[model samples]
Target: MKRQQPAQIKGLKKWLDPVYSAWTSIATHKLRSSLTILGIVIGIAAVIALMSIGRGAQAQILSRIQGLGADLLGIRPGMTMAGGIRGGFGSASTLTLEDAEAIKEQVPYIAALAPTFSSYQQLVAGNQNMNAQVIGTAPEYMFLYNLEIADGDFFTDYDYQRGSRVAVLGANVKQTLFGDEPPVGQQMRIGGNIVRVVGVLKAKGAVWASPDDAVIIPLTAMQQMVTQPRTSRGERVVTSIALKVTDQNQIEFVTQQITDLLRSRHRLAPGADNDFNITSVQSTVEALKEATGTMTLFLSAVAAISLLVGGIGVMNIMLVSVLERTREIGILKALGARERDIWGQFLTESAFLTLTGGIIGVVVGCGVSVLLSRFKVMTTLLSADIIVLAVVVSLGVGLFFGFYPAWNASRLDPIEALRYE
Candidate 1:
């Protein structure tokens, strides 16, 4: 066994020698190698950065929607058709307080309801004046939006009954109208009517039309001040109604019940188009997630085109390397080096080039992600899977494009190669 140790050592040296030589060849041509890897670095970095932003946006959207309560559902007036033109959501005031009341009274699966009316109006608080979204909703508006009173109290049911000119300020509204001073108890003029401030809401951050930038008042007061439509049933017209389900599992059942109830109330015949639409938190979230996922995939595909180009660049450089080292390959074959050894050496060089560039690209992408978020440009999320993908893709590119050049070197006729050189 001791005598055979020398042969084993020789075999190991033979295997390692080619890898070491490949490393040496790449190191000696630092400038050429660097330039060749630049395309790959750029491609991989772009893919990661764009994907990180997509992932972060998706998470934020899901979190915001989830925070609104999974059991929550929103009911808005259906599309309005006037002549040939089609109006968008809430264009017609078909929903009324009577509808909200009926749902609350008849729907056993419902936990709560907040009938709401909204319009954009200019608000004046002493010297500060700004245009803001004014919402007329029930006292449960804060609960529906997951908002808390930072100071004072929300307007009471008695205030709504009397159509009192009282209001609750959103975080942004408070900051804009009151500055550093207390907003509660201060009077603000909205739609030319002076409404007393009853409370200020806690910061909930900004999402799609977030309540953080809105002003809340009683539904009755809103109709009285904002000129909302009045129904023949002597009930106030509302733009939408928010409902809370007793159980998340009962969402579909409750939705069908609501549809039946509303269609009957609207006097629509069987199979007739309804005048209202009910949207659930879960369905909305799933739709948004699907859209975001598709967008991310499309953008990532665009970015990957650059990697394809980079692979072509790798092939070009490897071919050049083979030509430049023709005599070296010939000398190795003359010294009894096998064709497999030649192939392994060339393949190793190509792999080393990609692996190094891939590592650098990852660092670059992460740095760009950090910078974008630091400047508040946009959000970015980097996951372990993304990093692994970049490395694996780079290695795959090396193997795919490097094969032809490596094979060409391995198949060279040593006598012809030496004679030509």
Candidate 2:
């Protein structure tokens, strides 16, 4: 082992010579190297920026879906046909509190359920006023929608049954209406009627229905006190019913059960379309995931085309470098440099150039993402793994594109190279 050590050291030193030589060659051409590196830098930065938008959108969408609860289902009044033009979803209010009560009483495998009623109106508190969505729901609405009380308490069953004029303020609503003062027990006017604030909800960022900007009240209070009954749906109306299943596996079966029960109760003909729509939050999430993921990949592909362009720049510059260094290659070959050594030297230079650019590109991409996020254009994210991946891809791109130039140099005849210029 001791006798073999010196031979191993000699071999290692011989291998390292090409690496240092390649780096020296790259360092000597600062202007040319910088321009080549800039191409890769722009390509990588574009990739990071575009990918972040897709990923950020995906994250926000998933959060909103999760806020609805994992096993939650929404049963909304379906479209309405008027004057031969079909109105869109939520255009009708065929759902009722009785329907919710019936589902509560009859449905099994249900973990939670609530009646949803809502209208958008400007709420007034003293001299302050802000337009917000007024939501009328049951006691379960807080837990069902993943809400947490920041101050007082949510309306109880007694409040709903007695049709009490009590309200729960959302974070933004509280800020706009009450400012820094304690909001609990304060009176606020909705639809011109004074209602006492009972609780304030913790900050929940932009949700699907903009619930963070809503004032929550009891269903009975909303029905009896403030708003008039809609001429089309009349009294005893609800916008939708939200339910949570006891088990994830039982979701489809329970949804089917609810569907059949609703049809049977409504006494619909076999072929008649139901006036309501049932939607699973999980299904919505999966569908959104697929859509956003596909869009991300497509945009990423478009951005990645820039990387190929950058690679071509690397190849072009490397070919020029080879042409300029023909006499140097001949001198090295005459001094006992092998074809593989010449190949390795150029390949190493290419890898170093792209790798350095990749590191700088990551920083530039992150900076661009932060700026974009500041402007609220879209969101971006960076992970350690993504950074590492960009570097690996950059190095691979450099190696693949730099190969032909290196090979051409390695195959040149020593006599011909030495005689040139």
Candidate 3:
């Protein structure tokens, strides 16, 4: 045991000596070392900041999509191709109220559904005038969309059957037209037709499909006031239909059943495309998430180009370092230091420089992210895992870029280096 003690101490010194020598060399050339580290700092900070913004955007979009409920399904008119040109989705007036009724009666596991249409119209209340989206839907729309009434009541089935000219105001519409005054019982003109305001909806902030900026009226009332095309069988064309599945697990099955029924009703051949499209809310959410993820990866890759530039800077600085310390390397080699020792020392020096820069970059990046979120300039999400990844990548870059210079330093001939003035 006593004889082995000296050998263990020698082995420990072999590792610690290189680290100490590397630190001493770096400390001796503070200005040059700092300049080299600046490149790494900029690269890391850019990567972290851009990644945080991407992640935050993805989260916000997902939250808005999921707000509509996971068990919801939407049916909309498909695209139309005319003269070899394809129009955008929802451009064709293919869906109808009869199709919605058929789905309601035929499809199983459907808790509720509503046929609806919308158009932007000019609204006038007393002396106030503004343009807002006007939605025509059945009485079941309230339940399907999870809307709540803050004043008065939503129109009833009797009003819908009678084609009553009553309307419901969204929070923004009411505030704009009445401004602190109660909107119920007041009259508003929609497209030059006078309609009575029977109810007001609660405020639901900004969302993808929120009715906060829209007005709701019975479908029959809108059909009478607006000139819309009808099917050959006298069915009124509708914009879209919203369906609520009774069970989240049954969404796929319900979608399939609706598709088969609609295809049969439209008399579409087996090889032909249906005139309508059915999209489940869950599927839409997944698609959006995937798109956002791809965008984030693309932006991160662009930012990584700067890291590569920083690695090149590391290589350049290490090469200059090898040239400046050639005589010192010769003295160490003559004093019994091995080539591996010289290699390890230079590699340690390069790693230390990058590792220091990475820590500072993380601090700067986090501060910038917090400031952006604080001032509402943009949203940002910084996770610990990303920080760890940035640091590890910086270390790996140092080792990779430092290889050639370290090898050149280790292979120097003692006589040649000693004579190199």
Candidate 4:
């Protein structure tokens, strides 16, 4: 005669009652619940922070390497063995200005080339003197190295041909010598030899090599004033050559052609080792990428250990929780609650605890990452995928570790649990 609620509806309400009570009970023991969640929070935070740093570092490295120019190729003097002994393993003096000219004339795919020699010397401007690297290079070196002229202009072919003692200051060198004042047309002493400052380079942030710590001068001036001429031994000479290729795809072909040409010119016998090394920008980039990946994996592994520890902590706490709430389980069983309902209730409580901790950990981790990036300690990129993964992992931990305790509680004898005190 009277309207009756469906049995399923009544059962659903009864099932949810234990979950609600468990949450409230946990709230009553705030300190214990907080302590239990601390491990998970720290673990998640560590994972997030470490992953972000790794990604940021990789990005920074790749960007710097790419900035060197995609078409760049570097040639360095290679080791050579002679008379059954290592004779000229040092830098080869055979790579002269003539080699640079030969490469340009012979290699059709080569867009530009620069032969460079470097030495460290004291640079004096008025009363200010500081030790800085002096690089002897042609004007094309600027474009090959992606250097921009901030003021004035790079040395012309006339400067190289006439052996002008003109110099260009890198951004840092300019600032250190002249401060905010214009440096062009100023006379500076490099290794006690007077040289005119013809240009100031734009500021390029520090990379694998600091671009700001050097002064650029004509290669002829470096040879005449800075480096002592070799008498008999051909060991002292230009260190490297930079080549800009016309096509990225032709890098290997160009490298092989150059090697063959140099080997022939050097008169090395067939099957004998050549005395030069050629490196490409792509190879450098690949090496950097691989190193970054290794670093990221190592850091992530270390952080994962913490997550594993957190999972074990969750399991231990859930077991303790089941033991402590034995009386509650018995009362619920006595009140006609089903075993499945008891299982769900305990499982839900564990999940809620972990999920709450995970959310908090994500926020804290992101905040820490942002702060670190702002301070230039490392870069942090928080992606949507990482956030989703953190939450999923946290929920999974709860499910995996909470199951045993939940099942044990659900299977307890009501009479025995009721008398468990």
Ranking by lDDT: 3, 1, 2, 4
- Specify the poorest-scoring 10-residue window by lDDT in model 3: 1-10
Task: Give the per-residue Cα lDDT of candidate 1 at 47.
Answer: 81
Write down the TM-score for model 4. Answer: 0.78
| Superposition-based RMSD of candidate 4 using all C-alpha atoms, in angstroms | 4.7
Per-candidate TM vs. native? 0.83, 0.76, 0.89, 0.78
Every candidate's lDDT: 0.87, 0.85, 0.89, 0.84
Report the CA-based lDDT of candidate 4 relative to the real structure: 0.84
> How much RMSD separates candidate 3 from the native structure?
2.9
User: Model 2 — which ten-residue stretch has the worst lDDT?
Assistant: 226-235
Question: How displaced is residue 207 in candidate 1, in Å?
Answer: 3.8
lDDT of 1 at 121: 98
| Residue runs of model 2 more than 4 Å from their true location after superposition | 1-21, 27-31, 45-68, 121-132, 171-197, 202-207, 226-236, 267-274, 280-309, 328-345, 359-380, 410-415
- From the highest TM-score down, the ranking of the candidates is 3, 1, 4, 2
lDDT of 2 by residue, 113-138 (tens): 99878888789998999888898889
The lDDT leader among the candidates is: 3
**Model 4 over residues 1-421: C-alpha lDDT tens digits?**
9879899989998877766776896797798788767877887888789888988898888888888888999888776455656644334466666677778899879988998888899999988889999999988998898888899999999999888999989999999999988999999999879999999988888576556889999898888896544424453467778999989999999999999888886777999877888888799889888998798789878977887788787778878988998998899999998999889887887777777778887888888888999998878777777778888988888788788988998998899999998
